[model samples]
Target: MIANRAEPSMTETSSVWGTADVSSGKGASDENFPVGSLLISKALRPHVHAYYAYARVIDDIADCETLTPEEKLARLNAMEDVLLGKREAITRQDSMSAAVLRASLTRTGVPFETATDLIIAFRDDARGVEYKTWDDLLRYCKYSANPVGRFLIQLHRESLNAFPASDALCTSLQILNHLQDCQGDLIRLKRCYLPSDMLALAGASQEDILAGRTSPRLRRVFNTLLDGVDDLNRQASTLPSHIKDRRFRMECAAIVELAKRLTLRLRREDPLAGRVALKRTDAMHAALAALRGWS
Candidate 1:
């Protein structure tokens, strides 16, 4: 369970919460990593897809630039309502995503928090909340990233003993994503996931984030975050071994390896120059990782 999670502050469910589909058109293929990959059993794949679709819907609402904060919060509340059976979905996509996931969770007996907790983080994103310290960033991840891992764990009936390593892995991946998209986030959303104190400690300024390339001080900030990612990867490397399921273990191993690989790329390359990402060939390394973890 996510202990001591702060409730998001939003207006009471508006009487007339408007419905509009604001999907970014990002399918499973548009993600940074695989979703419902071959590692998961065919039978269990739909539940995973259902959960991903719900997440993507709420996520798109938070990131949609056109919606005001009130509109975003209202849409998010509507999603929660549909997800928890408080109301029926007004939009077709909402019915397909949130209402479906609600039914799926009822059948599977997974905790609703795995899906609802995401709204908290997305609410923060909608409000343009910024972080001050690494701990603050991790707290954001508690809502944003950690629940995804927890959902998988619960879906597979894994022990909570795996939570520590899983949280580390998820948080690292989230931070790496922040680093990779830092420039574009600033340009589009005016949001910076990079800890402001870390930037000040390294003598880097927000101005450096928008520049054509990473400045020296900004590079130092990136390296510091990467160093933290190194520690996280070390922690997350144990996640596969902690799992009881064979294929899921392989999936965790591959994801951990991808997180590690992306960390290395961020260290070696400049994200400000362009999007630093894994190539199709990187799948070979991920496959080998899965094989090594197979028992």
Candidate 2:
């Protein structure tokens, strides 16, 4: 059925994900893939953007402070219904995100299960769940992060052999983001992605995280976590070479380089005192890394 659906026009994709008015969350930015990057084949950009838009809306709903948990769950469920074709899309203004995702699935042959998996993860976030172990957090990344890589691989028609590497890369990126946002996630959402077990090992606790201050114990925890992140980046660095498409290979290389750089920063800096973000120079370095295939 997906194979039979009509491909979406570039115009449609731009209207949904490229419009200036979309919320300014990380999902809305070119964090995953730079817009108009020559590394992506032109035909696939719209579909990629559609996926990004779908993800952005879900993230915004889960993170919205003013919305009750019940409200978030209800909205997420409605999105599931729309994706399943169990309901027509809601009113136009409210439904654009879901509509775009549906179109993307149809046009790109990306499985609906991918989007549904993301919803499951967002639902977990809405429930204010905290991971108890490294394994637990990795499991969460299975739904929250790996699906995006799987979708991109499917879009590119890459071999299944590439999946393991992709999964490692995606999961690592998710953990990197969690480490970077540990303070804000605790302060605003009361959600801690850092494993409780690790915190214990570091002689830290949720109370310390809530205070948004890095104690000596917390610093030790961060350092240990950064080591793990470095290992993940090393594991993921091999993924670019596995990609069959040269351009996509470069893209994959760039992502690995960027993640490596970010992890390095996370290792040295205190997340509570300030934010860690990629600079223009970092972007340039990533681009060069991509070109050189030097993940």
Which candidate leads the pack in lDDT?
Answer: 1
Off by over 4 Å in 2: 1-10, 17-36, 92-94, 210-213
> Please, what are the lDDT tens digits per residue for candidate 2 over residues 167-252?
98899889888887888887787789989998999889978766655788988888877888788888898888788888888888
| Native-referenced Cα lDDT, model 2 | 0.78
TM-score of 1: 0.91
TM per prediction = 0.91, 0.89
| Candidate 1 lDDT, 148-229, residue by residue in tens | 9999998999988999999999999999989998998888878899999999998988899999999999999999999999
Q: Candidate 1: where is the Cα deviation over 4 Å?
A: 1-20
Q: Best-fitting candidate, measured by TM-score?
A: 1
